[model samples]
Target: MSRLSLFAPDNFPLIQPGQPLLPAIVDALTQGGQPLADNDILVLAQKIVSKSENRFIDLGDIVATDEARDYAARCLKEPRFIQAVLNESAAVVRCVPNVFIVQHKLGFTLANAGIDQSNIDPSCINEEHRELALLLPQDPDASAAALRRQIRDTLGVNVGVVISDSFGRPWRLGTTGVCIGCAGVEPIRDQRGQKDLYGRTLQVTMPAIGDEMAAAACLLMGEASEGRPIAVLRGLEVIEADLPATALLRAGNEDLFR
Candidate 1:
């Protein structure tokens, strides 16, 4: 029986702008004496990724078009960022007062195109810096690949990496972490055709283990407290080796909700 533990380092500092998260994480793991091992999964918060990549946007510097302002007025969002997100979005779903669901160019149908306001310096709120607002990486898979390479090079160990973000589920009250990118791990574990104790064949038993691991990491890497933006998940099944997150994405036509 492989057990899961959510490791949180005490009194970690806020990730500064322009800081690389991978090195910090490697240091943390070393300090914790929880060295990365084969089959281990490292779950990281997207905010850290965004911060490391300098993804932020200044609300004041953006000039909102009439259409953007009108939509922002209806959605109750900041016109500048909302407009930018809208411009980047491929499709706009719901545009009610103060809320919107947009499909980004990355094929992710998320709120505000994943634009975030939390965990940013207030002083930069007025600058027109595209670096502040992260454009979804051109290829999340590629990002995961790069991180995996870096981690391997830094630690001299083979391990899995997962980049995650918190997202609200439709009809659900709270949010949970979802894997936006991953490397060296099978994101989904399909159990269909497997038999149970009673010899009953398991069907529809695919588990989003990557998402589950991400959510577990988020519990310790809280949005506010804990300051720990990275977590190490040890003792996973060895089957998770070299697989990426795209293997977990449900086809839009097969999904019932989208």
Candidate 2:
């Protein structure tokens, strides 16, 4: 019988831009009496990765273009915010009053280009930067890889890293955790041609294990006011792979919605 375990270590202090995250994470795990183990999967909130990369954008610094202003007026959103969304989006999927959805630069279809202002510290919340928004990491897969390498270099442990964010889907009522970046993990488990209980060969079956891990971790990292931003998943007999979260995205040619 196999078993799986998931737990968050003691919360660390606020992280700043350009901070060395791997060392801090290791220190926190040591202080919390939960050290990193081999094959442990480290699931992290996307917000922290973005913050560490200094992806914050001040709304006051943006000057809305004519098209952005027009779109903002139609959507009833701040012009600068809309501009930021446009900057981060590969293409606008839908735009309407009080709602805007887009294909993020990272190829994920999300609302407002994933530019979030909630749960931000007050230090950047003064009048000058009242509408501060954090952008997703520019290259999340790279971020995950770098973090993985750092962990290996610092602790000599092999572990997986996943960067996740909350996303709302079509026909879904609320948000759920979704993987945007991953490293040292197999993002998908293809089970094609595998025999089922009835001895029927499966033609198409692919389980997104990375997204599942992200969702499971999300349960501990609540959407609002939850200081927990990291979780370690253990006992997953996942074969080490070089697949990124992008491997899990349905290609545009295969997407029916587009």
Candidate whose lDDT is highest: 2
Global lDDT of model 1:
0.75
Q: Across residues 56-93, which tens digit of lDDT does each residue of candidate 2 receive?
A: 88888999999899999999999989999999998988
Against the unseen true structure, what C-alpha lDDT does each candidate score? 0.75, 0.88
- The local lDDT score (0 to 100) that residue 49 gets in candidate 1 is 75
Superposition error at 6 for model 1 (Å)? 2.7
**Which residue pairs in candidate 2 have backbone atoms (N, alpha carbon, C) closer than 3 angstroms, thus clashing?**
none
Q: What are the per-model C-alpha RMSD values against the true structure?
A: 2.7, 1.6
Please identify model 1 stretches exceeding 4 Å from their true place. Answer: 123-138
Estimated TM-score for each candidate: 0.87, 0.95
